[model samples]
Target: MEGFRLWPGALDAEAQSQLVQAVFGALGTAPLYRPQTPGGRPFSVQMSNLGPLGWVSDRGGYRYQPTHPVTGQAWPAIPQMLLDLWAATVGGKRAPDACLVNLYRDGAKMGLHQDRDEADLTAPVLSISLGDAAQFRIADGEGRTRTLRLTSGDVCALTGSARLARHGIDRVLEGSSRLIPGGGRLNLTLRIAR
Candidate 1:
C-alpha cells in the first residue's frame, strides 16, 4: 500500500452533507446514467461527471470528453469543497479536470481495474466515499490484494507507483449509513483527464 493513502473520516458529517447537496446540484445538470462496457454490457453503477472533462465508456471504448454523453453540454464545474479536498489531499501543480460521480445501488459492485484512461496517469486518483460503506480492494506491490471498508466521509488516494494500480469495490454494505437518499453509495473520483 505504499502508494495508497487512506484518511478515514477526512470530512465530518456536516461537510459530507454539504458535499452531497453540491453533488445533487451538479446532477441536476448532468444526471446519472448507466454506462456500457466496451463489450456492450451495462455497468451496475450509474455515472455522471463534473469539471471540464467527463470519463465515458461504450462500444467506442473508454475515454474522456468535455461534455456529458447524454446532455451534449459541458460538464458543470467541480464543486468548491471537492477542489479544496483535492488541494489538501493530493496537492500538485494542476487541479483535477474530471470528477466521475458513480452511484452504486442494490448489489452494485465494480470489477478490479486500473485507472489508466487518463493522459496524466502520474496524477493521483482522489476518491471520496459517501453513504453506504464499500468493501474496497487494491493490489499491493507484493502482488497481493488488500481490502478495507471505505465508509462515508472517508477519503483516499492512489498515487505514485500505484497510480495505475488495479483496484475496485467488491460490495457495498447496505444500511451502513443514511447519507444518500433512498440508501446507496456515492463514490466521487477526482482525476486529471487531460
Candidate 2:
C-alpha cells in the first residue's frame, strides 16, 4: 500500500446515490457488454465507459477506443462528480481522458493484471467503488500481495510505485450494500488513455 491512497467512504450516502444515477445515465448511452480477452475468453465482469475514450477488449486485443463497440457512438462525457474527485485527489497532474466503468455481479471477479494499456504509465489510476464491497488484491512484481476490503463509497488511487502493480478484485461481498438496485458492485477507474 506504499504507493496507493485509499479513502474509505469518500462519498456519503447521498453522493453515492447521485453517482449511481449518473452511471445509469451513461449506461443508457453506451450499454455495458462483456469483454473478451485476446484469447477470446469472455471476462466475468461487464463494462462500459464514460469519457472521450473507452477501454475495451476483444479478439483484437486490449486497448482504448473513442466509440462504443456495440453502438459505434462516442462514449458519454465523464460525470462531473468523477471529474471533481479526480481533480481533488489526482489533480496537479494530467487529467484522465478515459473512465472505465466495470460492473460485477454475483461471482464475477477480475484476474490479477497490470493496467499498462495507457500511453502515460506515470499517471495514476483512480478507482471508485459503489454498491457491494469487494476483496481487492494488489501485488508487486515480486508477487507480494495484499487484500483490501473496498466497501461502497471507497475511493483509491494507484500511483507512484504502485501504478503498474498487478491488481484485481478477488470477489464481491454480495448484498454488502444496496446502493445498486439489482445487487452488484460498480467500479469506476479513471485513466489517461493517451
What are the root-mean-square deviations of the candidates from the true structure over C-alphas? 0.8, 0.8
Which residue runs of candidate 2 sit more than 4 Å off their true CA positions?
none
TM-score of candidate 2 on Cα atoms, chains taken together:
0.98
What lDDT score belongs to each candidate, Candidate 1 first?
A: 0.94, 0.93
Residues 65-127, candidate 2: write the lDDT tens digits.
Answer: 999999999999998888999999878567789999999996999999999999989899999
Please write out the lDDT profile of model 1 over residues 25-113, one tens digit for every residue. 88999999999999999999999999999999999999999998998989999998999999999899999999999999989999999
**lDDT: which candidate is best?**
1
What C-alpha lDDT, on a 0 to 100 scale, does residue 8 get in candidate 2? 94
In candidate 1, stretches whose alpha carbon ends up further than 4 angstroms from where it belongs are none
Q: What would the C-alpha RMSD of candidate 1 be, to one decimal place? A: 0.8
After TM-score superposition, what is the CA distance of residue 172 in candidate 1 from its true location, in Å?
0.2
Superposition TM-score, candidate 1 onto the true structure: 0.98
lDDT of 2: 0.93
